[model samples]
Target: MSNDQAEPETRPCGLTPKGLERQKRILDAARDVFIEQGYDNASINDIMCRAGGSLSTLYRLFGNKLGLFEAMMTQTSNRVFSAFEAVECAIKRQETPEQALKRYGHLMLERVLSPEAVGLYRLVAMDCSSERERIQSLFYEQGPKRINDKLGAYLQSQVEQGNMRIRDTEMAAYQFMEMVKGNFQLRSLMGIEISEAERELAVEQAVELFLYGATCR
Candidate 1:
């Protein structure tokens, strides 16, 4: 093909590649600083020094301190949603409601027990007094409410197929999730990491309770 007829090829410029890497480095450093010092105490200088980048890049990439925090929050939201999406995809492929529910529970337990999630929860707890509204909104937007919505849809499908008897699926989903999260997650937020054995016990217990309640007679 002639140059005029050839399709244009995309190429990564040096600055573009370096800039993307720089942004990732900044985010990683910021996460570490936030984990160590919590949100209110973490400073831009600390992040920059740990990131091994300059002020100009930080400002250009994330604007300011609050902007950086918002960026981190957005990243966390995406990470959680990505996990949810993976569970949903697995559910779709399995074509079995019971298996889907089991996979969903395991995926959620994994996400909730992650170190970054633990740090974020701790940061929110510390900021709740002054940042109550933001924290509350983030919880609903990125966590419980979304998960409940997905579970409700899944339960409705199971009911339609006569695999489960789900009356008031939304409420059922909420109750089931509360049972799953009631104490373990609260302890996780308080920085008490549940050991492997404890997590396994919780998962098995939750699965048993859910299957007992939802199984068709």
Candidate 2:
């Protein structure tokens, strides 16, 4: 074999278990760093320092700071919408609509009201750079839109099962989410933790209101 036949360099994508763990550390640190310092003020060096990795490694894995930020956001979005993955299973298991919705609403609120989510939302909203639209678009595509699609599918399934009457599942899906959220989530962004009892009441009321609209008249 000719010496020019050089060995293929191992690409440093965090696909393996070890690589995935390393990527997780970087993402976790990046999340905190970005939250502490807005995107404009945030730096790759700071993320690398917190993540205990070299800048070259970060660059090799993610094209730039923006790419890394997107990756971090995607990870967070995946986590936030993870509970929805079980919706189909729960429905198949014959769980009551209220039971399924209560669990989903609780998880959704928990994620939406979390400090990190609030911080991320603020970061995206405050960002006015050229890449702002790209970032916001990716944020929604990877996060909210994904959750909405899954929820819409679940609602459509219920409608077919003779349990509800919904003209537009998509509209109803967002309506339920909005009704459950309301101003409480906005207050959460301002660092106000509404009482647990209050949140429960809101969720219960939202679910009841939604059911009333969905049930056959």
Candidate 3:
């Protein structure tokens, strides 16, 4: 093959099932390494050691450590946001907005405050170097931005159905998310234990407060 030609293995759509599996393995290993070692201390070699893949393959697939990190963030965000898919379906089922928001709030609290997610958030927080700005931006775009957009779409649907009166669904989505998170997310990231009852109460209160402002009044 010519140097100018793209390699089939490196092309995203060209990857076979085995190649896709290997890619997943590498991403999983990267996630573990990043969480354990932080961004600056993590090495491509360490990830390759855990993933059991050749360096050339890893380089070909992700280009560099930053690329691998971006891909991992994207993958993780996809998994996190997938849980909210039920929100869309809830609309189809004609569930009340309260029911939908409560379900969404609970799921968001659980997923966003998970150990892995908290560790990743700390990993990003600890890095403040100029070179890591891209990593930070990628994290926001892949994680928070995507999350807000998903919930914003759900809120937009509610507004269309006249169940809510939000003029800006995006801002409403962000506010509702913050309400659900409350101080519990901060406590989780600080290694403080948050009881299940506390989480449930937070979600219930968030939904109530959100509806008071958002519902047709």
Candidate 3 residue-wise lDDT, 85-190, digit = tens: 7877887898888898888888888889988788888889888655488988988897777778878998999889887899899999999999889888679877
- In candidate 1, position 166 carries an lDDT of 70
In angstroms, the error of model 1 at 87 is: 2.7
Give the poorly placed runs of model 3, Cα more than 4 Å off. 1-13, 213-217
Model 1, runs deviating above 4 Å:
1-15, 128-132, 159-162, 165-168, 190-197, 214-217
Ranking by lDDT: 3, 2, 1
Name the better of 1 and 2 by lDDT: 2
- Per-residue alpha-carbon lDDT of model 2 for 7-99, expressed as tens digits? 223446337787787888899988888778877777777787889977666666665777788899889887777777887787788888888
Screening candidate 2 with a backbone cut-off below 3 angstroms (N, C-alpha, C), the clashing residue pairs are none
Model 1 C-alpha lDDT versus the unseen true structure: 0.71
**Model 1 TM-score, 2 decimals:** 0.76
| Top candidate when judged by TM-score against the true structure | 3
Alpha-carbon RMSD to native, per candidate = 9.4, 6.0, 4.3
lDDT pick, better of 2 and 3: 3
| lDDT of candidate 1 over 112-166, digit per residue (tens) | 7677777777777676344457655775666677777788887887788788887
- Badly placed stretches (over 4 Å) of model 2 are 1-17, 213-217
Query: Each candidate: what lDDT?
Result: 0.71, 0.79, 0.84
Clashes of each: 0, 0, 0
